[model samples]
Target: MPVLLGGDANVYGMARSFFEAYGVHSVAVCKKALPALAHSRLVKTAVEHPRLEEDAVFTAVLQSLAKAHPDKTCLLVSCADGYTMQLARCREALAPYYRFACPAPEIVQSLGTKEGFAEVCAAHGLRTPQSVALPCGAPLPELPFGWPVIAKPADSPAYWNCRFPGKRKVYLANSAAELEEILAATAQGGYRGAMLLQEYIPGPNTALGVVNAYCARDGSVPWIVQGQVLLQERTPEGVGNYGAILTEPARQDTALLTALADLLRQSGWRGYANFDLKYTSGGEPVLFEMNPRQGRASYFCTAAGANLARPLVEDLVQQAAVTLPVLRPSVWYTAPWGVVRRFCPDKHLLGRAASLRRRGCGTCHLLAPGEGPARRAWYWLRQGAYWRKVFANG
Candidate 1:
């Protein structure tokens, strides 16, 4: 009986890769919008319900799969927060039919809200940006920090109708006036959820590292690996996401990993989760956020030698003792031309090109050769359009 994996198509790629590497048979069920003939068995379902409507869609999909393959033991892994929460909401109905791999519902809820995670970090004596939360339609609060403060929603797109229009969604407000203007615009755009007003911390040359781990049924952090983001491109409002390169774990990443493990243990986190952190000027790790599911950086982390998805699936299916992988130091670069041409037109772009020219990093576009030429062309075209949107707003 092949394992059943379902979620956003973005995650299907990694899940497919994991099963392929392990020589395990599996099937992928993805949302209808991003449809492709599943090179493997594919089930198309509607996965675009608003937060409140997600549980119904998930339950429908699972019930469909169970009826089709009664002999298979399903293992559910969700990539998006909305889907994860929906699964948790229907845990009683779904868990009996499938093995669900996710952090505790409370932990997922806590990490889903930026304000909630900040409070958790503060309670643990972890260093986080000073933040203020404002409800929708409320008057903008007085700017606590000067210009370039970080502004983002506390609940992401879970509760808000407005998607980050462009890079302006998450801003480095240069002045109180700029912050107020952006806040007012965000509120007027139907952003009714909580928003975070935080002090900006700069690390221009810094790489964002994600530390992901799988906790045992008893809540022990058994498998841990860290990977660095070589390149990142986000919308101004921070809603849009783009390609990233996975690289080998950095030597400086150990302390941060330890700190995060301790923090999650203290918070009673179990199952798979990731931490987004960057080093400060003094080499101290600063917590940015926690993702209680597989992250965008999961690809990079797996490419760097630790296949997080496999261990997660193994734990969920077999309940076997987990072990971490020994990863080598290597670099992965993503859609460099797009990133360079857009965000780093001057120094950053040139610097990356020069580095690649010097054989300092390995590069691969996410689109693979096995994909149809038409699909590949469409992907690049869509990618070009997204970058254009980012720059036009800039």
Candidate 2:
């Protein structure tokens, strides 16, 4: 019997590492067209609908996998919210055919939405940024806090919009007027979802991003790993642009991470998830946000030491008891060449290329040498061309 891992291709790095570590064969189902650089032999299947319609697509995909591999143990690990929620909803029908690594539908829903999760965090005394939600069409909330506050849609479009090819917008406002202006622009642009206006927490040069793995049945926190802060950059709108540099564990940060882990255990969250956080001036760690699915940094964790995906697969397929690894402090960096091209388009291409050459960080580009240079070149060229158009208009 074989194991099938299905979800967005964004998780290919982690998924691939896990499959290899466990010596298991699997397939990846991407919501969009298959990437040209994917492993030659990894089965690639395309969904009928885009990411927002992942629920419908995944239900169909699961049915197909079940029919195609009835003799095998199919483990569905959703790396996107739409797929996660959809899988939970169809748990009854799919459970009889395949194993799923997710919490119950109600539990997932409770943690999926910002409002719902915020309420839970408040009740549990977790430290989250000060937040105020405004009704649609209403004036923005009074700015009780000062400048450089972060504002974003409380409900991320990961489920509703997926990753559309465009200049994504997430805002950081230094004044109430700025916040109001951005909200107005967003409303005018037809965004009607609930949004959060939060106090932005600044920290030292180094901060930790914690990824925890837990057991769903007893809410047992099994693994807590901390990734070193390499470099963090944000768009003008305050959305995270690049995360580079992952290093060995920081003990102080891990204690704070463990505290949050205890909270998740009490809340009955299971399977896999991550929390983004920063330490305050007083050295208190404050919560930034929670990802109810596989964190984008999963690859960094796998590359650094522990393979998160392996346990997830084992838990789903064999209900196996697993222990986590004592991962050494290691360094990870996003592909410098890609980051420069992604964020610094105003500079000359030659200058950007030079800057990347000087950067010292882990290189994990979707397209790198010995893998598929031609395909990587094509994808970046397309991305560069798209950005060129935006800058030309500006």
Candidate 3:
């Protein structure tokens, strides 16, 4: 069974994915009981603890859980950055009992930060948003980019550790004073890492591209999927999370796909890796960042007929050769149709979404087989709440 970390839509999606493949339930360790995991048949165990992100507490929970269930092989999977880093750091201690699907500790430290990822992309031929990484608590340096730049902490886990009056996952600074204000607030929150000030590419959410790939034990990335986000979560906390994807290869930037595959192959990265990118007006895809594990919306790959659960099981559990096809032309929905329509104003994609559903090429992560009444209600309620949040923000 996969011992997943963090309780959210992504973890539930992963549990459902594992259940669909092996007809077995998985375990989850989260800080709170989120709606997605409530009354779900797929999640056999949901462990909640406040200090789950702390190093000692994280290891103890898994080690205790492993001792409790020695009959089954426990695979450690992370759905959040803190868990992913902690799992990679504590791999040696947990190797005896639990199996891991994460990269090495060094790789996690090297590429986990935005500046570190920018360095890797620069070494390769990948295009990224032209900006600078300025050290926090220092005098704000002259930015290479213009006034309207994207700002966020270079490190995710570090940023999550601190609290402030108004802390966002990302910020768009339309002026120099706004940039200074964001940086000041971040430094005041006790984040000592560098801040990522990147060029803000202009486009609707539809211009964003998402990639999901899995590299096996051997240095081979057999499975890959590139998707164009049709609808995105518009709230501050949920920004950059893809709610609907249109996996039409014609619209996706293939060069980004090739560069990413090469990055995984040459870097010797194993397990699932997902990339977030935005397309420039010149039609080039600029990479935003990378997740060491599969992203929150990875179920889109499963919906596109390229199930992500099979490859990991084949390579790790079965020790068999793994090969799979890419995603076909389809619209994968993880949100309700009303929510997707409410957030996405593009007439072209709205029409495409409608036509695709009529022809039966549309697939939903929540609408899969075997969902119970409670989960069914949570799905709609969660989407409704998300819709209201976005509406209020506007």
Candidate 4:
């Protein structure tokens, strides 16, 4: 049994990956019930534990679940940064019963914070955006990189918990006044953490790329996956979510893969890690950030015929030699047709998306035979309304 933590589209994608790779149903655990997650045929059970913030409560919940299923081998996987840290903090206590994949608590805390990640990049002499940290209640420093900078939370999960209108994952400030305005708005929005002012890598959206690797404890990576971001959400709240992704075998570069793999190896990282990068005008890819777990866009890797979950399952459960096949060219588009048609600005990308659709490309939502009638009905009803809103707004 694989227990997935987090109930967004990313968790849904993981459930699908595990099911497709191992022919086993995985359980999804979330703080609240997500209708889309409940509709997934791949989820065997949906567990809701609302008080996960409390360590004792979280431990009890996991203890009870593990106690109930004594015979089954369960592997715990956390997709969200908060839960990853939670598990990492308590892994020592839970090691006797429940098995999970994550780095140490310190490692989790270090990589999850933007400031810590920047330090890691500097240690490796890796290329990353020039950035300045704006601490809470401090006077804004002189802009080092100039106008049109990107402002974002130093700690993403903590920042996201704050609620306010016009709050975005990444804020673009084209002028000094706009930068001050956004900073004031964010402070009013209740985000007390430091804000990162970064030099905006100039280019179209196509310059963004996501790369991943599954590292073993001994610093060996059996495989890697990379995806080119074609389309992503443009809304304030939905800013960083990828809506379309593509991967190809020929596109893999040894140097790029090694650089990312070395980051994992040096950090003693074990399990799935996804990196976000943007290319400079001269074609050099600079690291933007790293997600400690499998990213929402990980389904693109699975679509490319390299399911990342397979390696984890094999190494942890099956205890077998994990040989893998080469990744083939594939694409995944999660945006609704209405949203794509209305908001996607690139007509060339639209043409390519259409071509991929015509060729029967892989997708995140796979409503197939044997799916429960209620689940299927819920999927259609929810997705229809979602598309309707997207179309209306677009």
Candidate 5:
């Protein structure tokens, strides 16, 4: 049995993966009722959880859950950064009875922070945009990067704790004054963490690339899938989310894959990890950041025939190394039709729709037949609000 955290699309995909492979339902614990898992029949439990930041409470709850299922081995799966951090920090204490996977605490600490990750990339000779970290309420210094810089949080989980109306994860500042204004406003919104000012890469959403992999406990990656993002859900809430991903047979960047794999091995990162990158004018991919677990759009890898949850369960629960075939080339859809059409102008968009019915091509959050009427109604209600928001933005 797999115990998943978070109720977003990532957890929904994870639940489906386990059910498809092992025929066992996964228990999804979340703080709020997210349509992605709440409306899915695959999830056995979608109960609320305690505040994960409270380390003691989180550890106790995990212990309690593990003790409840004495006959089964429960593999803990976390899809959010905050939850991952808590699990990593408490891994030693819970190691006696519970089973969860993640990188060591030192590795998590270094790679989890934006500034720390940038430094790690620099040490490994990986390309990254010129970035500077500023303290809250500090005057913006003259930056060496170009104008129209991008400002984001150094620590996403902490930043998310600070509330701001109409706040996008990343903001563009076209001038020094604008940068300072954004920084001041962020501080005023209760975010006192470091603000990262990054050089904006000039390109459309198509320039984005992602690499998803499953690292074993020994730091070996059994499989990896790389793809190019054709579209992104640009709604305020979906700014950094992948919309439609295309994984062509020959589109894998060998050099990028090798470098990223080395980074994971050297950092001693275990479990599932994904990298977000953007290509520059010269076609060089620069590291944007690394997610400690599978991304929200990680269904792209699963839809391509390489479900990540399988490897985690096999390696951790079965205690065996499993070799998986390379994923097939396919297009993964997770956005509203209107949003996908708005962002992707490719003539072949209509032709690619045929794959939706095939095994290797599918969606992360589409309501299908055989589902209960209550779940179907919930799907439509959520879908209506999502598309309404996207259309309202236009």
Candidate 6:
């Protein structure tokens, strides 16, 4: 059985993937039971611990859980960045119990942040936006670029735990004053990590793209899936979160896929990787950042024929050969049709979502066919509430 870390959509999505590929009920461990995993029948167990974020607490809890399931081969995967870092750090101790693959600690530290990602891209000869890292609470350095730059946390894990008024995942500053104001507020809110100032790649929400790849031991990619983001979360903290994605054969770019694969091989990296990028007017994708773990919407790749759990179980547990196919057309949705229709800012992409919906191509990460009346009702209510939440916040 797989022991998933986190209670959000990533945990539930991976839990569902495990159950779908194998009939095993995966155990989910989170600080609190979020809606996605609360009433799901797929999860065999949900462990809630207050101190899971602490490195010592995380190591102790997972070690104990591994001991409990000694006879069974337990595979541990974390959805949150902090948890993923802990897993990599405690890999020596956890290795005896779990069967999983992750990047080295130094690699996780080097490639985990926006600043590090830019450096990595430079090493690999990949195109990325011009960026500068600003130390929090310090005078702004003279940027080689002009105003209308992008402002965001260079370290996501540190930023995730911080709560402050007017906090957003990313900020588009129109001038030096706006950028400085953002820096002041972020520092005042207790965010001490490096804040990045980048050249803004302007585009509609639909112009964003994502690439999900699973790298095997020999630096071979078992499968890679790329999709165009149709809509994104407008809420402050959820700003960068994708709400809908479109994957079709017509839009596939072979060169882009090869370039990313080369980066993985050159970096000597393994395990799942998720990348976010945006296209310039020249139609070139500018690398934004890389999430080390399978993203929260990892199921997006699963929908395009890359089952997240199957590869791990086959490669690690079954010790059998695995083959794959290229991705195909499909739509991945985090909410219901009603929610997407109402909240999607671009009407052109909204129409495509509608078309995909009619053909039964849309998949909801949180919705499953096995839910009973009450749980099912709760699921709909939870997703439907996004309409109110977005508008209210606006």
- Summing lDDT over every window of 10 consecutive residues in candidate 3, give the lowest-scoring window: 248-257
Residue 42, candidate 5: Cα error in Å is 1.8
lDDT tens per residue, model 1, 146-210: 66788777766443346444324356678768877877777666666777888777774234556
Minimum summed lDDT over a 10-residue window in model 6 is located at: 320-329
lDDT of each: 0.60, 0.59, 0.81, 0.78, 0.78, 0.80
Candidate 5 on 1-394: residue-level lDDT in tens? 7888777788877877777678888887666647676557788887676475688877777788888899988789988887788788888878877677787777888886677788899999998889988877777788888888999988788886777776777888898888777787788888888888899998878888888878888788767788788787767777777877877657889888888888888888888887899999799999888888888787777677777677887788888886674677777767765566666745364346434435436454455335688878877787678788877888
RMSD of each: 4.1, 5.3, 2.3, 2.3, 2.3, 2.0
Clashing pairs in 3: none
Judge candidate 3 at residue 65 and give its lDDT: 92
Considering every candidate listed, which one attains the maximal TM-score?
Answer: 6
- Candidate 4's TM-score reads 0.92
Root-mean-square deviation of Cα positions for candidate 6 versus the true structure, in angstroms: 2.0
Tens digits of per-residue lDDT for model 4, 178-242: 99999999999899989999999888677788887787655677767888777776444567777
Q: TM-score each candidate.
A: 0.82, 0.80, 0.92, 0.92, 0.93, 0.93
Q: Candidate 5 versus the native: TM-score?
A: 0.93
TM-score computed on alpha carbons, candidate 6: 0.93
Give the Å error, residue 259, model 4.
Answer: 1.1
lDDT for residue 199 in candidate 6, whole number 0-100: 86
| Model 4 superposed RMSD (Cα) | 2.3
TM-score of 2: 0.80
lDDT of 6 by residue, 1-394 (tens): 7999888888988988888878888888877777778678888789899878877887788889989987889988778777778888888888887887787888887776677778899987888888888877778888887768989888887887778999998998998889888998888898999998888888887789988777776667766778888878755666778888888777767788888888877776777788999988789889998888788888877776667888777767887655675566678988556766776768977787688768887788788668667778878787668766777887
Query: Which structure is stronger by lDDT: 1 or 4?
Result: 4
Considering lDDT, which of the candidate structures 3 and 4 is the better prediction for this target? 3
Model 4 has a clash total of: 0
lDDT of 6 at 376: 83
- The deviation in Å at residue 114 for candidate 2 is 1.8
lDDT of 2 at 182: 73
